[model samples]
Target: MNRSARRDGTPDRGRGNPARSASDKRATDKRATDKRATGKKDAPGAGRSGGAPKKPHRGQANTAAVATNKRGKPKQAKPQRQQVEANPTISNAKPARHQYVQSAGPVKLAAGEGMRLQKVLAQAGVASRRAAEELIEQGRVEVDGHIVVEQGLRVDPENAVVRVDGVRVVVKKDLVHIALNKPRGWQSTMSDDLGRPCIGDIVSERVSAGQRLFHVGRLDADTEGLILLTNDGDLAHRLMHPSFEVPKTYLATVNGVVERGLGKTLKAGVELEDGPAKVDAFTLLDVNGKQSLVKVVLHEGRKHIVRRLLEAVGHPVKRLVRTDIGPVALGDGRPGTLRVIGPGEVGALYKAVGL
Candidate 1:
């Protein structure tokens, strides 16, 4: 051995490298620890040390510290699993809310419920809701035969007798729907300011103004036929909305023979000054070499739409008559005719318009 390579009887300096250094340090520490333990054990009478006793590792561990007897089994605890039934009271509880749909009847009302007398009158079929309100304002509506103009007056439904225009109201208990054959020069309006003839004037004396009559839509004062009059506001609203697209059929007489392209123009939808307009159906009613009559139906009720439509296609409407709206049709009733609409007819009218 070279003298420079030997130190303390060792032939060479210890191994060098990460693994060898770590392993050598561990073996050295374990040997030093074992010597300390042996020193303590050799002197059983050694004084209490500042630190704890040396622990026995895997080689000298006490078997009884953590083990069962090798040849015998220890008793195990049995788990208690209790079975419980579901609660019947929670399952049987009633729902908190209920739904209410519109019903045709004398709706039971309470005092101070905020329901108005005219609304009750209208719903009871004494008149159109609008007409009923008008009658109430006119002081024609009476609660228990006393004229009441106070709109906010809430009357007890079961205890009140409502009369309009001196006529006892017998709420028809049915929706009233009528299709009037509107004559030339008669307007489709509840009340006319110019005092010219209106569709109401044409209603029979039996179906008086107090009956809550009203026009469902607008018609030029000169336009004629198949005008709808009804007391069902919901049905009217549905028929008027664009979602329903309720079609109205009309027969128009024009000045000259209209080209087929005119019908096409109407069908394709014309952009009017008001807005875009649509025609669901159109056909030539009659065509003479000089004059022509055409039929057009639309889901929209634009202002003077029939006239505007004919003008868009280069033909001015010399005359116009609404032949149908939804399911109601104008048959052979004379120009000035009027009649009461039956309950079935009203239901059919509502059904036709998809109420």
Candidate 2:
């Protein structure tokens, strides 16, 4: 047995082999010294015990850096970025180029020329200013028969025939108009000195406090019908004036059957105590043995004008109910019912009065 052999009979290779040349040994030793100086890594599994893999050398260059090209695509010749110095006093700094951009809307009106449409609507109790603008934009508003679809349009409140959703809106804020079914017992007056039922009682119930309202025309205590009430003094005067000739309709239940010629006789003209009175139109609605129902239309606001005309024709009125005045109607309203006149009806009234 050789003394260099191990217990398994394998010879150790650490000592120089007798078959290797001295020059080869010297070359191998030079390689080991170069590896140590350059910090080169050993092959994997080299110098490892228990079949474990070898670890990377600590001083070796990073694998990624070694793989990367040393001279990458020559650095791009980039333009140097201009660095702007921020103004320390920002408030005093002016912008480079100032732009004055006007937002889109209706053209501005000259001062004192006219009022805004929405403002006029709000003042007239139609709707809020914002809501009125929405209405105008929706093409629901009109001025002088032209549908306006923009905001900030200036309009003459007195002259512009402005309508919202096809209903004319009177731009007068301080005015109000109402129609009431005047019951038979109620007098057509603001108040009764005798404490009898008068218009004030109905006004107090319907109108807000502090508003001064009066009937456009008078109705007798025994007469039941539609009566216009308003705070507009000029409108009331025109409505009651005989010049405008705003027609009024009345339903009269009279004594005795009315003959066919009664309407023609009333239309032709009837002699009255105050002078001659005539009906614009007339109709005999229903006739019974004891009572007759007649419909009469007249523009006269004289006291007992309908009664006088009917009596002159040999038919006395038993019950007189005025059904309409101008464009307004009683519309199945019970006695003592007060209704607020809508803008459309008010517009009709204005037309009837040359306003």
Candidate 3:
């Protein structure tokens, strides 16, 4: 209630507390010191006022220096590229080596040195040259224990071992030549698809093992008589070739009597569907009032040529029999029989065909 007391009856501390004022002054000073220290530590370039901008820290200084250098000076020239040589032999680079190398091409042989693979097979009596090629491609032929599929491979026949169908083949100096009197209802081929009779059934009994023989030409089922079977492929090929003009003789019995001058007419030529057919020679063997037997010799190997010729001339063939081919004859041998041809006969056939 004196000069220091207010109308609300509270005493004023501003005139009464010395210790409190001193405590406030110390706290204010400590706060000011802490603020100055924090400002000094946090502010950049605080200790280097009025001087050149302080250098950055070691890592930052290096980065700034690099950037300034890049902007201030021209870039140094890059190292010159080295020249590379293309040739491996001339350059230091080595050519790549291969573990395995392929052959450049097929092998070649000298003339008259080695025989062809097909020819060797034919000489061995395995088959004809064409059939031999097929056998080779079928992997049925081998030389010296290696399968041979490619044709034209020359081999030393005397030294190189050959096999067909797992059977060894020996080179034969004397080839086999056979003449078969193929009977009616017999097939000239070695096998028949219809299970009928085959010429192989008869010849297989006479030939040795691993020796295969084939007919030189085919005759129909109803046809009978001379059919040459041989292992001489060259001779057969030459005989069968139309260019050789090897003559074949046939005897035909016709249903009707052949008119006079029919022999001459056939020799001259006859019109056929395929082409003109002609006989090299013709002769009337026998004739009756109703039927006639005629002999025809032709060089062309046409299907049913003799019968077709007679049919065109108003005569249907009753029976047909091939009597001769080239110099080989059926002879008096009974039907369904075969005989080994003499060497002289084979030589004659070879000569006839210009082998």
Per-prediction TM-score: 0.51, 0.60, 0.52
Candidate 2 runs further than 4 Å off: 1-115, 118-150, 154-168, 205-208
Q: Write the per-residue lDDT of candidate 2 for residues 97-214, one digit (tens) a residue.
A: 9686654534446767889888998877788999989988888888877777877888877667777776667886667788888899888888889999988798895456677788
Tens-place lDDT digits, model 3, residues 1-355: 4876677888755455767667767866775688788863423443233535577765564443354444676455579988876775676656678555544433335777789989987866668999999998998977766788888888877567676776566555546788889999888789778888999888776555766688887898889999988777877898888899999999998988777799888988999999999999988889877999989899988888888898998999889999999888888999987787754566567568654
Error of model 3, residue 318, in angstroms: 0.6
- How many backbone overlaps does candidate 3 show? 0
State the lDDT of candidate 1 residue by residue for 196-278, as single tens digits: 78777777453563567677887787788887777767778887777777788888888888787776777778998978886
Better of 1 and 2 by TM-score: 2
Q: Which candidate ranks first by TM-score, i.e. highest?
A: 2
What lDDT is reached at residue 32 by model 2? 84
lDDT of each: 0.70, 0.81, 0.79
Residue 254 of model 1: what lDDT? 88
Pairs in steric clash, model 2: none
List runs of model 1 lying over 4 Å from the truth.
1-174, 204-209, 342-344
